[model samples]
Target: MAPTIHCVRHAQGVHNLCTANHVIPDPLLTDLGHEQCAKLREVFPYHDKIDLVTASPLRRTIYTALESFEPVFQAHPEFKLIALPDLQETSDVPCDTGSEPQALQQEFAGKNVDLDMVHEGWNSKTGRYAPINSALRERARAARRWLKARPEKEIVMVTHGGFLHYFTEDWEDHSQYQGTGWSNTEFRSYTFSDEDHNADLEGHAVDGDNATLVETAESRQRRGKVGPTPDRAQQKTLYQLGTQSWNQQLSTEEQDSAKVPEGEEVNGVRV
Candidate 1:
């Protein structure tokens, strides 16, 4: 079987809470983001199945991986942490601009991040730091190719929301959200084509048609958040079925409403 790539959006960053005219360069995670990272240990169902843990070079993503997968690292010391600059957040944004490799190593020396694979000054933009959609697309493509070349069968990456949409090419899934981006600590799974010939010289294009998105525990948790919104028809149906099993007295109308309703809001609102 082909490897399963698990892309994880980093926990909330200070910049996410407050964006200034000057993008805060390589911001750290907010307290809420740290809380979310801690919850990932409980929410990530594939803890035992993961073969490796990789992350963007940015402080937020690196910290997310360190916090979220602490147990995995303890159990499987062989799975070293790799800091991939190619997988770093889009460079056009100020917050996404990473620190120098030496500085990062100095700042995060206690972490088990392997900086050898990262290119020198990989996240530094040459001209100006401004969010450019096209540039981000190209960077995502490069990151995809790099990930495809990895030997591990199951991999996890902690990265940024701005780059994830382009990386996964699943804009429709997140487009409805306020920022059209994923929530903090959101983890998604995708299965790529096993045949390397399917990718062009630039590797897989932004076309996600070839990839299959699988639902994870994190996604389910997002959907189950209690709010004023209408209940999901699937959840409602399952509840009715359970009632029938326990009380043996569900009404026909109740049973009929179990079917998933048309145009139901999904992939919206953060939990």
Candidate 2:
């Protein structure tokens, strides 16, 4: 069976404070952020069952994973926090980009966090890590494939809110003009969909492999009663709108400076 994925958006960071803080390069978690992690640590029920813990290389995400899953690490010393470069935030803003591997290693020295998967140019907003729509889609696909191939039965991932939408391929509540609806430290559980259907919405297929993720019933129950679920047609429309929004944002950024606009209202909070 494929591993059950617990996707968590990083807790509040310094950049989440105000628009001005968005320029802080690789900002750390706020005091509330740490408290949120503590709360998650208390409520998270799979500490003993978790076989792997992964997170984006960004400071906030790394800290979130370490703090929120401290019990898991304590119980299983063999598992180190895997830093996945492909799980980095979708944007190239200063707050979203990660620090150099050396700096991260020095900061997290004794924390049992592994930076081996983070490449030299992982933080750069060029090439595969570009903020454009196509690059992000491909990265999301690769990340899904990697997770599906893992041997672990239960896994945890701490990543940004914007990228979470892409990773899950569910844009039900996504918005291009504003930030994501995912709350700070909020977590959703998912299981890989069956591979009977080989092609994705984009017609991408790999040896009849299906990388779609289906949210577990427990996760939905945690969210309480919500509105009616959108149909397949609605989902595809939302996905296309999300892709177009990303491309439009990329074009605007290319014409202007790499920095966000003065108001600093990004697609996702602090992204």
Best by TM-score: 2
In model 1, the runs with Cα more than 4 Å from the true position are 127-134, 194-271
Summing lDDT over every window of 10 consecutive residues in candidate 2, give the lowest-scoring window. 262-271
Per-residue C-alpha lDDT of model 2 across residues 93-193, encoded as one tens digit per residue: 67877899889889999887999998788999788988876677778878988999999999999998888888887777675223454777989999987
Clash totals in order: 0, 0
Q: So what's the TM-score on candidate 2?
A: 0.87
TM-score, structure 1 vs. true: 0.69
Q: How high is the CA lDDT of each candidate model?
A: 0.63, 0.80
> Can you write out model 1's per-residue Cα lDDT over 54-155, one digit (the tens) per residue?
898889899999899988898887667899876765434566678888898898776677888666757665422223444554566667766766788888
- Assess the local accuracy of residue 184 in candidate 1 as a C-alpha lDDT between 0 and 100: 75
